[model samples]
Target: FIVGTITSGYYSINSYDYLHKLWLRQLIITSFHHALGFLPSYNILSSFILRWLGAHIEDNVKLAEFQQILRFPSNLLNIEHGVTTFGRASLTSFTMTKEGLCYVDEIYLGSDTNLGNGCTIMPGTTLPSKIIVGSLTLVTQKYASAQSNCVLLGIPAREMPFVIPDDTSVINDLSSLNSSSIYSLLFVCLSFFISKYLFIALYLSSPVAVALFIHAILFCAIYQYSILITKRRSHFTYSEVITHQQYFLFKLMSEFSTFIGPYLSGTQLLPFLFRMLGAQIGSDVILPDIRCITDPHLVNIGDYVRLNMGAYIQAHTFEQRILKLAPITVNHRSVLMSNTLILPGATLQGQNHILPWTLVMKDDQLPPNTKWSGVPAKQVP
Candidate 1:
């Protein structure tokens, strides 16, 4: 009987240890992602000095150079031994907070994953190799398992999985994929992003659009500031913030950012531009500003879909309670207008429209032919 009791105790300890490790991983990942966002603006001389002071830099994860403030919380952990370059970018990390608690560990970046301007990566993520992450994307979760060469967009990124088979490798005929092809692709992207109706249509009616823009901005600024204060006053290190319910809050915030930001971006020109400029965007969708994606390789945007201004779309959040993967989709020609938030694992079909100031829950679908508006947005006419 004693032996059995001892064995049971051992098992319990083992389970606790496992949970601890997971918590640690979560904390580490969260800290680096948050802190890196605020670091990009430091002058090279400053970055060098910081590095000389033993700053933890991750490999293949480059921070942009134009960042203004750099804040790494106390609980920062398990950073890889690699060079993180900073382009023109601003960086900021949250202070330890009661509301944002979770443990994080190592941030793994596949070779050559670049972080664009103003992009923020939250803790506990793994980015695959050779991916171009757009600017201003808020990334959270473990995406190390994502297929290489995929593109991710928005706050909570949805991976658009695409494979360039070995059979079609360019080395066999590198000349076939010449500079013109690259330019053509660039033109298509540029035209799609910069089309007159693309971002301009939303701005055509400037007054109401400006009001909505201000509303969205104020909401985000207030919320973000609150989160920052929570982090700073708590005395939690980057790693310590993810310990309890706070972890869940960050997960919620990350998911909320993903949903709200993209929904807002899906709106008309002004509001969309504001959110897109403020948040990170990945690869899949066409965003007005290229600098918004933090990890582009892990995002997927559907063809002919319009993410109107102020739309927030997210793919994944905290893995401790339940591992989740939620992606937002707008079918061909479907429009998700300003301030529309789509939660994890949502699907919207073509010709379907989500009107302004709407919030969509998880695992929900919008009928293709209808329009949805208002809080908890539902079909209207």
Candidate 2:
């Protein structure tokens, strides 16, 4: 009995220690991810953190803010030098079958590879060097043997007969033009820590509901004040060197919006908050996710509109290294379904229904009472 008791106690202590370490690691990762969302110099900062976490990330790799690496240890992921990623690329190292089986493996990206916005790199996939992947592409393990110097596009990401350009110099130029200073990151960290502690103190002293209400009010007031002081404009060309400061300020505002979106999303407070930030939001609008609208001030939404999950309103685009800004209008009673992307200068007339996964191109205007569907959205009879 004595021997059995001693063995069980030893096992229990070991289990507890293991669980504690696991929890601490997860906490650190989550905190790091949230902090990186608002901080500038995303590529450099993220690469440093990722290397610390044991990922094999080489020099000169550009990782965009808000990208996701999921379901694998950091050591299982490998990224080579000069690889660049744009907007929210997801590298998932695990997959589950319908029958409850799971597969997990390493993911590798070769040198000078580029992944576009909203692309997915599946488990066990290996991308070759000098490969250019288009936006919204899905790269599977079958492409592991693909040749370098090719373009990949579409849902399943088939290769196109196009030669990949050596745009390393261009990427470096853009990075210099757009990178935010460390001071901005420090400011964001300070604000976040102060707000976090304030909320904790309030929660300890007051009822939950009252504490939340007061915190929300104070947060909104501070956020609005900051926005007002920035003196932002609706339209501006972003190519000139003189406008770099203004561009950085614009990025800071965007980061703030992204940081606070989850707290007010799907609530009545969201529309009010957007209005305070200069958006022309009308009555009875249902905004499930505010993150979808990158530039709220450049957006105008009419009455009784419903924007579903993943419905994106992009008010700006970059062409030939020049940033073009425009307004997006969703007329009264329009419904934007899941994953609908409305590009800059796109307008949807009254009572229009945009189906799931639709892409409304720039400057495209749809008629009233129309139902649209597909990648480049077309009217569905």
Candidate 3:
């Protein structure tokens, strides 16, 4: 009996030690990911850091600033050379089902693959080489057999009719900006430091509510000042090269707003803050998440419009390695449901109801008082 008890105690100690090590590793990885989001450039830094954290990221891979690997064993993640991600791609390596069964698996991205903004790459998924995944796509293991050089779109990300060209234009464009991007990186870091300093100073000297309000106002003022210095413009064509200070500052403001959004959301302060950032937000507009508006300066929201959580209004897109920008208009009394993506130049005429997870394509003009649904958003009764 004494021997059995001793053996049981030894096994328990080993189990505890194993769990403690795992917890510490996960904490370190999470901290790094959070810090990486604030960095202006993530290509080289992200690849190096992720590799150090046990991810198998290959050479010349370009990861977005906000890309994250959720719930690691990050060692299971493997990316081939020349993989690029445009915006935030969530690579989830772990999942639990309703039956309480937990699973962890590998996620593989082949060479020359491009992931669009807000896409989620699920565990056990294997993307082939030269694939272009559309924005907000959910890529699962079911599509593992998909062919290379094809476009994947929609919720489960099935193959589309488009084929990607075998050219180095995107890589070339990205390479050309590396040297020029250093200035933008420095500017972003300086801005972030100043903003944090301002917030800290105010917080230490005043009441919590007052301090937050003053910090937000000051931050917005600084953003506007930078915009003015950069000669803020409303439109940009696809042919234009956008390695400018203004673009970096724009991204900084977007990230800042998103960071503070949860604190100010569902309050009048949210719209007020967005107004200070140059958005034309109207009275009684309900913005549940400020992250919804990617480009506040180019978005015009009308009265009584309700934008649900995860409703993203993207005012820009990249085509053929070029940037294009346009304004988005959400007219009065319109309702956009959760997880809907409104693309550049989309006009939701007054009194429209857009359902959850719908994608309003670029330059679409939805008629008044209509109910829309689907990936490309056609009117549904």
Highest-scoring model, TM-score: 3
List candidate 3 segments past 4 Å from native.
1-43, 65-67, 70-72, 95-101, 163-168, 172-194, 202-217, 225-263, 319-321
> What is the C-alpha lDDT profile of model 3 across 271-306, one tens digit per residue?
888898899988998888667676678889999999
Q: Order the candidates by lDDT, highest first — what do you get?
A: 3, 2, 1
Residue-level lDDT tens digits of model 1 in 5-109: 011011222355434433343455456774443222211333333344344443222233423323332233223322233333223332123544333333445
In the range 1-381, model 2's lDDT, one tens digit per residue, is: 101101101112235432343234445557677554554433355676677667798776766553365223466778998777766678863465565434546788988787766678887788888777766678887775557878776567788666543542323333442244354446556655654565467779999788666655655455555445224653333234224344344443443355566877888788887786568999999898767677677789999999998887888753312346788999999999987778889998789999987778779999999999865577999
lDDT of each: 0.42, 0.66, 0.70
The local lDDT score (0 to 100) that residue 162 gets in candidate 2 is: 61
Predictions ranked by TM-score, top down?
3, 2, 1
TM for candidate 2 is: 0.65
Better of 1 and 2 by lDDT: 2
| lDDT accuracy of residue 365 in candidate 2 | 92
Error of 1 at 364 (Å): 24
Candidate 1 TM-score, C-alpha based: 0.30
